[model samples]
Target: DFSEGLARVKVGNKWGFIKEEGGVVIPPQFDEVYDFSEGLAVVKIGNKYRYIDKEGGFVFNIEFEWAQSFSGGQARVKFGDKYFEINKEGKIITQGREDLFPVKIGDKYGYIDISFNIRIEPQFDEACDFREDLAAVKIKDKWGYINKEGEIKIKPRFAGCLSFSEGLAAVSEFDKKWGYINKDGKYEIQPKFDMAMDFSGDRAEVKIGLTRYYINRNGEIIKEIIDIEHEEI
Candidate 1:
């Protein structure tokens, strides 16, 4: 990600990579270009997949049906109907495409890393992407969480869910209400509200009864969006 400075963006569009300060360095010549991540980005040219360095140099030959932005040294790509990850050399980084999705081998869902590696086993009723080294996994029709090692960090309880952010995750109870959960799956903000969302910039939008408000990370009321005592119009 261009966290600082500007240049001709590493990728291309009509104007290619736009630097942070708004300088065109690489000169976007790519039919499609993505933001730089880990010093590299995915680029496309004439129906080919490849990677490009910050200087706009092609790092590898385009050899995939489709490609996406690189993340953690790899990117999710497709080849002839199957998706996989490829290194900068345009080589399949894994044994095959088995790890590119949450495959339900028999009757469960889980995650797989780029190497066809079972980062999380297929043992959950459902699963979501990993965030903060953790992911939401369902068990017995209830929601929970698991670590990268496939260990259950938080037991299934929520009725609905979302990925973690700013240290909390949205959760819902089967009989109670929806709220946010800490890393331990315990309701940091109890399941008392009618609905809630994860924390964003130290504050989260929350709903109680029929009112919506913003709350700090500590679950303390920060501002009420509709105080009802205020005038509208």
Candidate 2:
């Protein structure tokens, strides 16, 4: 089920879309189906995948061996042997051998292009997926941010750090307390929370003492959820 007024259902060997009342809307004709995003969903037929609108109509003629949902109007799709970004209109935004995602080599992590080209040398002990155009990477027990060009955007400093959310990321220092930092690596919210979470809709859920509360990006508590149960991740 998704916010687009449709739910996924499997009937026998195929999958399709249904309504809240279990009424078949698209029928079980697809080999597989992914959740709707924006206004389209990825459906698999035969061996190729294509994007379909709410009425189960193809949005464009473009098809791929594999495809992912659209985000920010761009979707990642795998062609014959390379990955590329396609817009809603089915125009390739970035093609060629650029992987645009991180790759693991031996025991190190680095970025690679679609053709498996080592754009960024494998050197980090640990790395995470890119968020807000920057990725959190660990080198020598310190975490920092890196740009797509493999250059250090923020020097490795924090004991631990998370991917950016709402233009800020949660970081921890030697004290093991969580705070928020901007893209420039400046502390926008000082370390205070015993536990922190990523910001969503301008608000973040945090824990202090034994209670959970929601805080704005300014680090001000907006509301508290009493008697809630949670465990540290």
Clashes of 2: 4
Per-residue lDDT for 51-132 in model 1, tens only?
7787777776445567787776667787434576666555567453223345454577766555434556677777776777
- Give the alpha carbon lDDT tens digit for every residue of 116-183 in model 2: 35678888988876788899999999999999888999999889788898998999887778999999
Candidate 1 backbone overlaps, count: 15
Residue 22: error of model 1 in Å?
Answer: 50
Clashing pairs in 2: 97-114, 98-114, 99-113, 99-114
Error of 1 at 66 (Å): 9.4
Model 2 regions more than 4 Å off = 1-99, 227-233
lDDT of 1 at 70: 70
Q: Least lDDT summed over 10 consecutive residues: which range in candidate 2?
A: 94-103
Q: What is candidate 2's CA lDDT for residue 217?
A: 85
